[model samples]
Target chain A: MSASGYVQHYSAKVSDIYFIRPIKMFKSRFKFAQTKVAVGALLLLSCLPFAATAASLEAQLSQYAATAKAANPGFAGFSAARGEALHTRNFASGKPDTPACTSCHGKDPRSAGQTLTGKRIEAVALSVSPSRYADPAKVEKWFKRNCNEVIGRECTAQEKGDWLTFVGSR
Target chain B: MKFPTRPVSLGLLVLAFSALVFSRAQAGGGHYYPPVVDPVVKEECGSCHLAFPAAMLPAASWKRMMGELENHFGDNAAVDPALARKITAYLVANAGDAAGQRYSAKLLRGVDAASAPQRITALPQWVREHRKVPDWEWRHKDVRSKANCTACHADAELGYYED
Candidate 1:
C-alpha cells in the first residue's frame, strides 16, 4: 500500500533468507564435524592398549640389542635361530634337575610350560601372549633366576636378545 | 516294648555334640593355619611356590629364610631390602611360635627353637603325616617337588591339608 512499507517488507525477507538460513545451516554442519572428531578420537583411544604394549616390547628389544652390541665388538645382531638352539640345548653345568631351558619352558615356546614346583607358566611366545617381554624388569628378573637354575650362570646380553627375538617372532 | 523317644533324643543330642566338638578340635589343630593375607608376601614368596603358611614355621626359620634370599634354595630370589623387611616382619609376627598359635606346638615338638629349621617337610609331624605317600608319587611328573603341597592336597591353597 505505501513505498516505505514495501521497502521494509523486502528487507525483512532478504534478512530471513540470506542471514538466518545460513547461520542455521552452519550450526548443524559444525555439530556434524564435532561428532566425527569425537568418534575418531574414541577409536584411536581404544587401539592405544595394544599399540602401547607393542611399543613397550619394541623398546625392550632395542634396549637388549644395544646391550648386546656394547658387550661384543663384533656383535651383528640377535638371531632367532640362536635363540631356538639356546632354548632347546641341554647343559650339565646347571642343576641336575634342570639342565636345559626346555626342562621348565618345554621344547616349544608356543606351548605353556610347568615349573618344577607345579606352577603353570604361560606360553612365552609373543604370538600367544602378546604382553610378554613388555616389561624390562620382569624379563631381566626371570632371565636371572632361570639362567642360574638351568644354565648355572646369568644369561649374557647376546643370549638374552636372541631369546627375546626368537620368542617375539613366534 | 514302650517307645523310648526321650532317651533316644538325649543320646542323639550327646552324639551330635561330641561329633561337633571333635571336628572343631581337629580343624583347629591342623586345618586352621591361616594362608598368607599380606599381598606383598604373597606376590614375593608365592611366585615360585605356594607361600607356605607362616604358622608352619618358627619365627627363627622365617628370619633365616629372609636373610638367605640371595641363595633361595638354588635360585636368586633376592628382593629389595625394604620389601624383604616388610615380608620378614609379617612372617615372624604370624610364625608358629607366636603367642596364641597353639596349633603349631606339635609341628615344633622336636625342632630346636635355636636351630630354626627351614624345611616344613622335614618336621616330625609333617614326616609322620606324609609317611604313607610312596616315593613314586613324590617323583611323579605332576608332583615333582615336595614344595608342591597343592599336587596332593587339592585344597592346600585354601589352607586345608586334609587327606
Candidate 2:
C-alpha cells in the first residue's frame, strides 16, 4: 500500500475509535444501569434544587429563632399556632384597607391571593410553593412591608419565626 | 421610451413621507407605554404591581415618587437609599419628558410640567381615553384598579395595549 493510503487508513480508525466507541459505551452503560438504582438516583438528582432552597429557608428560620432567644431571656420557642393567629389577626391601628395580613394574603395561606391593585400573589405555604422564603433579603423585604401595612409596626423576631414556622409546617 | 423619472420620484417621496407620519402618529397616540426594561426597576417595583413604564410620568414625578417611597400611596415601599437612587435614575432617564421619547408627548399633552403628576391614570389623556369605561367595570373584582392595565389590555406587560 502507498504511504498516504496507510496514513489515511490509520486516521479513519483513530476517528472511529475516538468518536464512536464512547457513544456506544455510554449506550451500553445506560442500558445496563436501567434499574431501581437508576430511578432512585434520578429522583435524588431532580430533588436537589428544592432541597437546597428548603435548607436555606430552614437555616434562616433557625437564625431568626436564635436571635429571638438571645434578645429576651424570657423568650420561649416559636409556635406554629401563634403564627397562624398572627397571620389571621386584624389590627385597626394599621391602614384600614389592610387591617389584616389576610386582607391581601387571603384567608388561606395555601391558596393564592391578590393585591389591592389586582396583581395575583403566589401561595405562601411551603408545601404549595416550595421556593418561598429562599432568599433572606426578599423574605425580609416583604415582612417589613406587610407587617407595617397590616400591624402598623415592624414584626418582632419571634413573630417572624412563628409565622415562618406556621407557613412551613403547612 | 421615457422613464417618467419626475412623477415616479414624487410619488415615492409622498409614499415615504406618509408612512413616516402614520408611524409617528401610531407611536404618539394611545398605543402602549414601553414596559420596564431594567432588572432592578422590575424587581423592586414589580413585586406588588406591574412595574409601570417610566415613560408614563415625567422625570419630576419619578423623582418625587422615589423621594417619598416611605409613604408611597399610603404604603411603606421604601428601599435602600442606594437602590432607590438607581431606580430613580432609571425612571427619570426614560420619563415622558426625557430626550428621544416623542411617543410620550401625547400622554403628556395636557399635563402641566410644573404639577409633576404621580398617577398615570390621573393624566388628562388617560382619563379621556378611559372615559367610556363604566363605573361598575372599575369596581369589578377583576378590574379593581385602573393601575391593573393588564386586566383589560391582556398584553400590557408585553407593551401592547391595543383594545
Candidate 3:
C-alpha cells in the first residue's frame, strides 16, 4: 500500500488498541508488533509442510483404528511395543525371503532398508523420513504387499495402526 | 547421497537420458543401460528392485515376465490387469530387440529372443562380465544381492554400471 494509506490505517488501529500510550511509544510498539507478526507468520509458513504430513499420518492411523474398532468392540489402542515386535517378529507362513518386515526394512527404523531384490527402501521412522507415510494409497499398497509377503496375508487394521504408530513415533 | 527410489514423470527426459547413454556407448563402454523413464513402469517395477532397463531383455522376455507377475521370481507381484498391460507395453516397446539398442546387443547375444529369458543376471554376457568378481565380494554385507547394482556401481540409479 502507499505509505500515506498504510499510515492512516496504522493510526486507526493504534488508536483503537493503544491510544493510552504516548504517540512516540506507540510508534515503537507498532514496529515491535509488526516484527513479531512477521516472525510468527514466517514460522507458521515453515511448518506447513511438516504439519500436513503429521495430520495425514495421524488421519491414516485413526482410519485404521476406526476399522479395527468396528471389527472388534474390544479393540484397544495400538501398542508401540507390539508394533515393534511385529516389525521384527519372523513369520513362518509367508514367503521365506521376507520372514519379517525387518527382513527388508532393516532392523533399525532410522536407517534405510534394502528389498530382497536389493532396491533401497527409505527409512520408516517418521523422524528420519517425515514425508514417507504422507500418502494413504501409497502406504496402504505397500502394507498390503509387504504384509502379504511377510505375514502371508493382508495386515489387520490393528496391526497396520500399531505399525504406523511405532514408525511415526520414531 | 540419496537416490530417488521413486522416479517422477521423466518420460519426456528420455531424450536427455539417451544422449548420456549414447555418449557413454561411444566411449566403447557397454556398461550403461537406460533407466526406466515411465513413472508407472518405474514405480511398479522398481519398488522391490532396480527398474531394470527394458533394453536389457528382448520383447519375448518382458512378454513372458509380465504374463507371470503373480509368481514373479517367486514373489506375488501381481498388479491389476489394466496396469499390468501398461507396464507390459512399455517394457515390450523398449526391449533390447524392439528398440535401437547397441549396448545390450552383446548382452543378449547367443540367446534366442523366442526363448524369453527371465533373469537378466543369468544373461551370458552378464555372467561373463562379473566372472572376475570374487565370490567374497558378492557375499559382502552390502553387496549381498546380485540385483543390488548400486552396491558397487555407485551410479547404478542413473543407469551407469561401470566396472
Q: Could you say which candidate leads in lDDT?
A: 2
Predicted candidate 1 versus true structure: per-residue lDDT over A1-170, tens digit per residue:
69999999999999999999999999999999999999999998866765776888778778877888888889998899999999999999899989999988888899998888987778989888876666677788889888988888999988988898889889
- Tens digit of lDDT per residue, candidate 2, span A18-67? 99999999998888778767889999987876797788888888888889
lDDT of 2 by residue, B7-46 (tens): 9999999999999998866784457689999998998998
DockQ order, best first, reads 2, 1, 3
> What range of 10 consecutive residues in model 3 chain B has the weakest lDDT sum?
B3-12
RMSD values for the candidates in order, in angstroms, are 11.3, 6.0, 13.5
Judge the docking of candidate 2 as incorrect, acceptable, medium or high.
medium
> Which of the CAPRI classes, incorrect, acceptable, medium or high, describes model 1?
medium
Report DockQ per prediction, comma-separated: 0.52, 0.72, 0.46
**Model 2 lDDT vs. the true structure?**
0.89
Error of 3 at A109 (Å): 1.6
**iRMSD per prediction, in order:** 1.1, 0.8, 1.3
- Candidate structures ordered by lDDT, highest first: 2, 3, 1
- Residue pairs in clash, model 1: none
Candidate 2 pairs with clashing backbones: none
Local accuracy of candidate 1 as per-residue lDDT tens digits, B44-146: 8887799889999999999999999988887779987999999999999999998887657777888887798988999988899889999999999899899
Clashing pairs in 3: none
